[model samples]
Target chain A: MAVRVQREAFDIGAEIDRLRAGRTSVGAVASFMGVMRDFNDGSGVQSMVLEHYPGMTERALESIVAEAGERWPLIDTLVVHRVGELRPSDPIVLVVTLSAHREAALAACAFIMDFLKTRAPFWKKERTPAGERWVEARASDDRAADRWQEGDGA
Target chain B: METAHGSVRVLYFARLREAFGTSGETMDLAPGLCTVADLRERLALRGGVWAEELAGSRVVRFAVNQTLCPPAHALSAGDEIAVFPPVTGG
Candidate 1:
């Protein structure tokens, strides 16, 4: 498993390929990408700056990936989360999981992203027409992460 | 006991950083300030904006030594404490 928290943009295809390199046991590859948007909270967002705690951000991602590994029979995983200034359509994060079958790969992919949304230390400050304002944590995101704890993975 | 030796590096992030006017500082642990909540309460006791931002009704999060923790988490010398708003990342 690899977790990269960097300011530079990441190539999704390359990351997935790296996980599958010389691994024939992997039968499934599931991935998810989150991108920056131009509009939020009924306003036009001009840009956004992603802020994160230096050492803690990496530890959070690694811990989330480790949890996913325990929940599924994952062969390999890659998580790339971008920090710094971003504009519309810029990719913000990527999560990919490999497994012997689709079930584990797909569930683990969703689980990783869901947990990352709430647990990761990064915060977003969006520059809108009004002014630069920090985005508030959404209750929906908490609910999304909490659902995984209810029962077996769907 | 060398209570004077109990100093920690405290960090503030995002909005907290902006409001506090500094990113971080080294704090000499006050007497009896043994928990994260106690530290916050002590800071809040500073009054004015310090009280408004940290001591008010607003909710903030805490992390001890780079890992998230509850308010009651124990504090020690050399610990790295972080205070910030809730996380909004994916």
Candidate 2:
């Protein structure tokens, strides 16, 4: 597993190759990429600064991936998150690749991303034309993360 | 010496910094402060409306020893505590 908070953007193609690097047993790879949207909570966002509880962020993500791995027999997993200032359309997060099979890879990939969305201790402060404000946590994210508790993926 | 005589360190993040007007601080725990909640009460004793914001039922997050924890987490000497609002980053 890989987790980072940086200003750099990740290349999905290179990441997949690296995950599959030196491995022949992998059959399928599933990935998720999150981007900064132009709008949040009805506010027209111009730029956003991402802040995280540095030590806690890593632990939270590792636990999330570990939970996903326990539910699915994934070959490998990667999570990358961007920190510092970013603009709309810039990549904000990336979750990539798992599997001995497509179903396991796909399901685990989705599950990991969903879990990270809600459980991770990262915050976004959006800068709009009017002023800066912290983005609100969405109920949809909570519901998405909840699906795992019901064992809906399995 | 038991080496337990130093002040308690409080760390802040995200919106909590805005609310507290500072990111991190160290305060002598005194004789009565023992747990995370007690420390919070002492923080409230600092007076003014800032105390009200710190002690209010806002959705603040907590961590002790770099571990995400609750207000009930028992704290010992030299423990690092962090406070922030509910996270909204992906």
**C-alpha RMSD of candidate 1:** 2.2
Chain B alone, candidate 2, TM-score of: 0.79
TM-score of each model, in listed order: 0.95, 0.88
Interface RMSD of each: 0.6, 1.3
lDDT of 1 by residue, A90-146 (tens): 999999999999999999999999899998999999999999999999999889999
Q: DockQ (Cα-based) per candidate?
A: 0.86, 0.64
* Tens-place lDDT digits, model 2, residues B4-79: 3567678888877877789898876566676777777777788775576566775666788767776777677677
Docking class of 1: high
For this target, which candidate reaches the highest DockQ against the unseen true structure? 1
* Segments of candidate 2 deviating more than 4 angstroms: A151-154, B1-6, B47-49
The CAPRI quality class of candidate 2 comes to medium
For every model in order, what is the number of clashing pairs? 0, 0
